[model samples]
Target chain A: MSTTRRVVIEPLTRVEGHGKVTIRLDSAGEVESARLHVVEFRGFERFIQGRPYWEMPVAVQRLCGICPVSHHLAAAKAMDGIVGVDELTPTAEKVRRLMHYGQIFQSHALHFFHLSSPDLLFGFDSDPATRNVIGVAGAFPELARQGILMRKYGQEVIQATAGKKVHGTGAIPGGVNRSLTSAERVELAADIPRQKRWAAEAVAIARDYTLENLAFATEFAAFPSNHLGLVRPDGTFDLYDGVLRAVDESGEKILNDVEAGRYADVLVEEVRPWSYMKFPFLRELGPHKGWYRVGPLARLAVCERIATPEAEAARVQFDEAMGGRPGTMSLAYHWARMIETLSAIEEIEQLLDDPDIEGDDLVRKGERRPESVGVIEAPRGTLFHHYVVADDDTVMRANLIVSTTSNNEPMNRAVESVAKKFLTGTEITEGLLNHVEVAIRAYDPCLSCATHALGKMPLVIEIQDAGGRTLAEGKRNS
Target chain B: MSESFTFYIDGVPVEAAPGMTILDAAQAAGIWIPRLCWHEELEPFGGCRVCTVKMNGRSCAACTQPAEPESVVENDSVALREWRKALVELLFAEGNHFCMACEKSGSCELQALAYRLGIAAPRFEHRWQAREVDASHADVLIDRNRCILCARCVRASRDLDGKNVFGFTGRGPERRVAVNSDARLRDTDLDVSDRAVDICPVGAIIRKGVGFTVPIGARRYDGAPIGSDVESANDELESANEHTEGGAAATVRQEE
Candidate 1:
């Protein structure tokens, strides 16, 4: 008689939202497949149907507390298109850009040092209780403090420009509602050098650690897949403003310079029965070949140049070290994250130095248009906020494609690859189960942003024998 | 007696003056009854039924009802709260209150009442009724879609500003706020300093060119809930009364 066994991992820890990893084994105890189930559902699109277009930027920020600024700016960008302005006033543009960079700086710092560092600084197999930011703080006090301060500085920058940090209503249609005062500008610029040095040190430490663990880093969910990101007209990395680009595993461009508003023309989303998040893919390639990786690693892979000097140097080393290929190793996300943080810090410094940043010409008036699509390279990846407005300026429809959801297919494949490689027998230890979480964490996928659910679920891992009887389980509340 | 009055609100005895209304006495005692269209600066206009409270087991508008001595008031009961919530839902349904997008969102009394009452969503189906926006005013916009027929603007215009520029027309669902001058606000004797512009409870009467002047998180009601000050006031008053004689018993009784 043949019997099938199912292993379920619930509420993946350190990540934003509740998610489960289910792996089924055949009667022969051979791996069948693995799936990441997003258990929460949020209907932001359905309820926001009758809202005003101008309010979308603020409303959409409610999607994720960790990355509200990304949604704020992306929604504003879409509203700008509706307002029929291609470019904002210089002061308005600089203010919004500063806010965006601040978000990127803080979000990257949060994920890298606070979230990912616990796993990397302390070995993955280390005691779960002591394997966290607290553990990192106990081991490397200065590193942990620097990480905290880095995020604090980023928040300060955000507060100065956008006004109350997270979910600030700074950016609006046509342009921003307020401008940076001279004092606010000085306050932001004052801390740049310290932040810059900290970013550089973080990149050095992350790169060195990644290089030292070359073997495991290369083997951890390392598979060739497509990479996607946004790039400036000159092919430089840009998080806030740019055109989308998609490249194959060999660093060959498949989709280049696609306008942000025209995302639907090139991409499509497919729903799956197992997860709440819909899998997005290239329109032409369909599901199989269409799956691609996003976020820092993908952004680094697609961009040819870094606009800032220090970040450019780090990118060069990163590309060469990662074999000059997109999707070389999933673990390289940490390294690329550090590089992006450096870029964000540099951009913040530059924006602060610009005199126009403190100018008072913040907003422009215009007639409302019928529809708009906004896109921005959020800290995670590309974020899209599309809205249709009636003649009265009330929102008729709202469609959002968050970064984590866009990476749904790639995340699932990565989980499976890690599970197949690591899960050898029936006995699933905490350390072994952590290997699976490490793969999901490598992507730094914000399941909260993806699912948009009301409440969070605890991360759980259950190993079941032949007839789906629980053999072992691992659970963590945090 | 000394011409003073005392009433039991939520079964706790509260002091009041003879002529003071229940709403006024409650305000002096730092007890909050969710209300709209009854601004302290303006005369009582019980157009909004949100402040309906159980007076001796009968429903009455708290803002207009005078405080009667020895009367039992049921202001904070589950059934009364639900009834109030239902009234708020009706208001929300009647008007186009897209709080997420409104300029007066954080400061809007209607939105704050909804938030304070924990009304996450309106229970009733929304009447997506089309309303005209009177942008004829060069400085002010009268978006009828967001108007809740609170009459605060009308009262402010007629009484406070003495312009008598705003009034209500029609009846029931068709009843709407209208400017006195048939032409436009610019043609009327209205300026940037009109009281009606600032008296709107919703986003209906907003000054143009200054939309979203306050950043969202920094806006009113962002840092604290709408009636948090009132709650604090109640605590302060209760503690102050405790410093006086016979306060501890009243405080304990109110808690119970």
Candidate 2:
């Protein structure tokens, strides 16, 4: 007699966009393989066709409301190539970089303090009813308020610099439209010290909780995987502008200082029948060995130093405490996220102090070209917006490789690793299932940005027998 | 004429001055009647029919109808709101009104009306009509896809600027706004400072030098819905005038 089973976690909660987890169990009730499936698709690429290249920046920003700046800047950078502007003016460069930093801070604050902290502080097995940001607010009101305020400050910067927090139209091809005003500068700078303090406290909290769980840190959702990020030519962390960098699991550099536009030469996307999300891998290593992670943890692992002084100090401590090599633990992503937030705040302060940030020469004009590519480090990971335009400058083809899609293969691996370690029997418990979610959450995947879904995410989990009969199920929201 | 004529919209009584259209009188009474092609500065065109209201049990275009004495006007009924929403959806489906990409997004009256009506998705199938963008002008671009045939530009050119540089061509689905010259905008007398350039109710007419000068969040319609002040009598003109024509895209930045 043979026995087989399957487990599914549908509409995973506390994450952007829709997703499901499926685990196959062998006849002996042992784990076979697990997969994280992205279920929704918005054909942004197909619809973006025929739009003028000048419109790409504004249009692509609508891909995800949460990370519109990432898309906005990336598309603008690609548009820079189309207009034949190899480098932006010094003022334009600073303004765009400031906008990018603001986005990273807000998005990371949202994920860490609001989404991930509930599980880290309350324990994953805690009641699903009280295990959310509301629960966090009930327990630690000040922390919750700080998180909201931090996010607000970031939004205010985006509004001042780019135009709006959600889909600001400040960025354009070649350069930005306007520079920061003195009044706006002073207003944003006034809150800088307070924001830096909050970021520091958040980082301290992440360090403590993440360091406490060594076994889970090293094992759960943690596996040997390649890492990808962007770094300045001098080997420092850069979120807004830099060359592509890739490293293997051992922290050895595989590719360094590669132009972001040439991403196709180094990375290739693999499509699986089961999901709309494409798994991107390194061209030389193939899918299995090429699977790598991109984001906070990967960024921390790939960069030698962070530019900001305070964030650099935090990085040193994180490296010393979380094992010297970059890929020591997976949960360290939380710590990296906090550090990145701190760096973003510090960068904001730095940009404000510089007099060139108010320069009136905001735009640069150049000869038009037929095709170009834009790449930037989104809060999640590296984002690419490629466009081919006609002589009339209308878009002919568009290809986008978002951060979450690039991490699809490794996200699946993390889910599989967690399932195999925690789930053993035919029957599944809530605690074990939460472990799977925790593993996935460690990466802070934004499925909404990944698949470009248009609806709110409602998470669900189900366990079934080999015959596809439902045996057990759990749901958060329909 | 001494006694103001009274009308009720959504059961609220409103007074109208003599010779005032129902739409204009409704604005004076702080009642919002959704409209297109009815700029306060320009003569009413009533081409789009977005401000359709039921007057004494019969449908009428509010912008073109004079407010009569003791008139019962129904403007905010559920059926009318749905009708306006459907019309906006049809206009959206009929054109490539990609709000995400359009330079006139926040300030676009059509997009603002759609947002005001809470239109998440259109009920009609998108025609994906192929349209032409004439960028031959030294400083103006005419993208026909975003036009809703409001004719504000043509009137502005003829009456305000006296350039007579714009006209309508074709009919029905094939009908479109066109430059007066056979060649392009460059051949016509239209300049960056022309009244016709900034009077467009949609992204159809935009200045070349400025695409995103005001940024998305700080644009005229970002915070308040279109005509929020005119209909509400709140006077948001102070904030609205700060960024109206200073930026690159010198299109319609004020509510008409």
Candidate 3:
């Protein structure tokens, strides 16, 4: 027996930005099939079609202030193809690659340590008032400070290149709008080794967390018949561009080198009646048999190696989680994120050391051309932007594949697995659902980018007692 | 693509770059086309429509029309007056174009454009759209009716800002900027430096801070509609010994 309960989330106040999560467990004491409902979509995909081709980098970068550099780079890649001006000065590309790495450092730190770490380490049920970084700050201020400095390093790289953070206006199609100074590169090089040590220590802390015995299936791997690669001979780690590959549990390649524009062929979105998000799968394998995951865990399995020394050491430990061949394990995603964080930092440093980055004429003014797709392996997953332009260089059409859309299926599957394991017969604790939500947040789905929206932050979860009296409820305003 | 053509502006004949917009050409020639909706950082949107100049016999928005041969653009002059006048009229009558009620009153683009054009009153009948002020956002607010369908804010959200936080819904005068996710901007991943606020031609879009700091004077489009009318109102400050033609010419300077 279930009674109707209307719980209104009044603008979830003071959180990340905008979002709420709502969960309804039937009277039968089971998730009547959970729904990850995203009530908001910013409509970025729809309106961006008519935008001037030249301004794509600055325009799309504003989609989310948090990861402006990534969006800026992706849009630049798409615009680069539209303009057909590929005299990409080595220094420009290097600075771009470096700025991108800085973004990875900051964003990964934010998502893993700040957003997802609290739930995993402190346990999600640890007092709402005490559940924040400040709550953790009293105990783990060093960790928090490390995350902030790492993020600042990335922001500084962007500032050095473009001018400021947020809407830095750094990456431009054909090349970057601004160039970096040799002095900036020197500073970046000096900072990387220090960051590398911090990442090393962070990885140590992450590796120590044993997520086993959490009641979830530690052995069940989703469509593990594919190894993934993002812009490399094999998926080792290529940030700017890559084709997504899926391998099976036994570690055999099912999908290899494929173009990103045709990514829709492999990722078929499944729209659950309950979720605003559509699940993605390997289309060639068929949905009935296709299940794949992207982002850090998926990336670790797809790539053959991590290019940086500090990260490679951590990769070995991360690789060990997948039985040495990059298998599918939900908890292993956290470990992979830390290792990639190290790789991302080292890669940025290497890019900074390049000498050709100081030239001012990096971008060709008023140059635009045909259709092209900018493909990159976002720290979350494979990201692709396909832009079709007119002969006059006006953008006619655009199709974007965001990290959230790629991970939607795996996220749901993981959530279901976790829910069935823990919440099947229990007190319907908030901590259990928080864990499940963190699993989805681990992918750091840019729903704002996926839907091409103005903004969206939907995390609506409702709770009530056995007699239908309100016990406690929490809403996601951020 | 149209064949390349040549055009003249301000007495100089120039070759029009193939497939170039008028704004692009003007920019290439080091000519500054004073604009609100057209930003280098954002996708070109002819929302404010203030950049309209006489090309052929007819006036067209500089941002929307292509730059081609056999076309002439007059940024300032009698021809520019008619366009600016009409442009001000539309901005005045549309939504709640109440210059007096706004804090961005004097410095408002619509008001400044009007003073430049010498609009005695909004000649057109006002079709005041019932609008609301959404103060939900921490930094900014959306004044619905004051907005002229110029998509500067939307462009800023998508192009320069990358927030994709605000957009236009419906079509024509029924058009309005809606926050993404249909929630107040406070609910979205948005900030005040949003280009939307930057491009608002009227008092419709104003930043939370710096409201009413400057006083407004003159009537509609005379001394100053944009907050501090220092540039346009300088003549009035020294009207006693000032050249009588000076005030009129200054208005003409802004008109073109």
Candidate 4:
């Protein structure tokens, strides 16, 4: 069977943004190769020229409403660096970290619990009518409720700390302007215990699930650690203020102290005329072959230790599943996220009780900067924000490298593996192609964030036989 | 417990009982809560909900709630808290808050809070209710859609100004803080200094054409706590009404 077939998914709708996927089959309509397409274009870098310094926060935060807090905080930190305000008053730093925690807690929960799990827990063909979390609620009500409750608690911290959740005015250039009282603190403090429980449950569930999928791990796995977030010596995650380190599957830190200023030297971005998204690869690995990843799962692999207890335990669970060392299995990435959620909760609780936060001396009134860069471990991956400003405080230029762009190479490998394994020499069938898309979905690629702003399937097939010689190749959208 | 303590608030201090209201102490100190529906001139009315505060225990309506033992109650806390978010959510859901489309965005307490709190979207669905805009008075225009039920207009109409020119016509989210005479503002016996204009929080009751004259950033409540702005707000309202059809707006001027 050497027939060629085509599966094309255009204007990938329903996700946060957009993308396209193309599948090619052989002569007998058997599969040949699979290519995932990312499409959408907006030149935020070229577009941010000639804006005011203080005004950049308002503008960059709009880049992603889902993680506005992180963007704003990172932007603030970069501006601080640019203006030489390295020492943030105790209260401002405390508030800044607390709000940053809010972003992590919410964004990760939305992904691991709400977005991706709908498929993993529910099973793809469990009747579309009852295939959502609402359906999951009908079946596993407690798990679903716990998921939502944890999300609510995380969002509540954001709301209580910032006066509102999505777009908060809590982060100012020099420092924060708002203060929290003891009563609000006590009220907020009460949510920690409940949050802790949900994180534990999530971790436990991830552990059990990973144990079930051994072949997917031991046989087919690919992750390059050459580029990812670095944890600090203090053990806490270094998202907003930290170093960038990339590792290979063999536990090697090839690059270290890759500061935001030098990101261009090590990282190279290229564009495909077919798709709008620009792919970023590790220079050492070079071009299409430079396989790298970012975000939570990539973070755990590169770091030496997790500062918090829950996260440490989750790391242990990962080691146990991988037999002493967790390699590059995408399935285990789900469990790793659970560990991250736990780490976020514990860190937030400790931050809320910081003594420095209780006193004054947060903001320094007027401390404008000339230029700066901000970076954070966005849930999908690592997000970077760079800004240049004139003496007039207006923005001169802006560039952003969304997290999903980094994982481009490895994600392609996954699709290539799945397509090759399932469709090596058979007639192209619908179910096989749908399975290809699922593998990519497993990465949870946020196309909406990837192109700097801007799939279908089918059935099973027959036995080995000399099949009809397929003519020209065509792509199908199901 | 009865010993008087000196406290400085916006440059004013007044002695109060161990359990007296900060709003009351401010009034005694001549600091004023600048509240709506609150009358030292009459019985306390909490419906205005504009006199909310941040006390030691929790945020509460200052008109109906008391002060803590040692801490001063601030209304900004109430205006920016969960209750305020919910209250604003309720207000937004109850009425249409289209700023660019409405005449009150710059002067609207609702819009000001949205900007202050960074509320980009109204959490709940807008009611989209079509309200009556009564222009019966030769000079006064009553737009029921803009009424936030702070009751400043209602209380000012009946108690202080004694014109009885306004009263709330309905209840709940549907309540209309309305004019009493059922006539346009200009057709009533109401004078320009009527407290109704003073008590109005949003631009529901302006003297007309003063909407764009003052820059939104420098308005009275910019730095003032939410409910606390009501008292001083009346004087501004009274002054605004006194200049009815007169020209005065700082950077800009209302219609002549």
Task: Work out the iRMS of candidate 3.
Answer: 16.7
TM-scores for all candidates: the values are 0.78, 0.83, 0.64, 0.64
Q: Which structure is stronger by DockQ: 1 or 3?
A: 1
- Off-target runs (Cα >4 Å) in candidate 1 are A454-457, A465-472, B1-36, B39-43, B46-102, B110-149, B153-198, B204-211, B216-256
Write model 1 residue lDDT over A344-423, tens digit each, in one string.
99999999899988888877766667888888899889888888977655578888999999878878888888878887
Best by lDDT: 2
Sorting all predicted structures by lDDT, with the top scorer first, yields 2, 1, 3, 4
Q: What's the lDDT for residue A151 in model 4?
A: 79
What TM value does model 3 have?
A: 0.64
What's the CA error at residue B186 for candidate 2, in Å?
A: 10
DockQ of each: 0.28, 0.40, 0.03, 0.02
What is candidate 3's lDDT per residue for A1-478, written digit by digit as tens? Answer: 4453322232222223344444445556665444344555665666556434655666666667677777778887777777675547676677678777777788788777677666665775676566666766777888878877877877777677655655655666667656766777677678877888888877877677634532342632222434354747655667766665677766677777677656666667676664455666677777766766767777777777777788887888767755787556666667778888888878876776666666665655334457877877666667677788654334678777677667666655665666556666577555665666665665576666555444545455566644556646666545
Docking class of 1: acceptable
- Candidate 1 or 2, higher lDDT? 2
Error of 2 at A236 (Å): 0.8
| Worst 10 contiguous positions by lDDT, candidate 4 chain B | B247-256
Q: In angstroms, how far off is A104's CA in candidate 3?
A: 0.5
TM-score-best of 2 and 3: 2
Residue-by-residue lDDT tens digits, candidate 3, B68-133: 776777765665657667866876787776443354544566655555456666689888676655
Candidate 3 — what's its lDDT?
Answer: 0.63
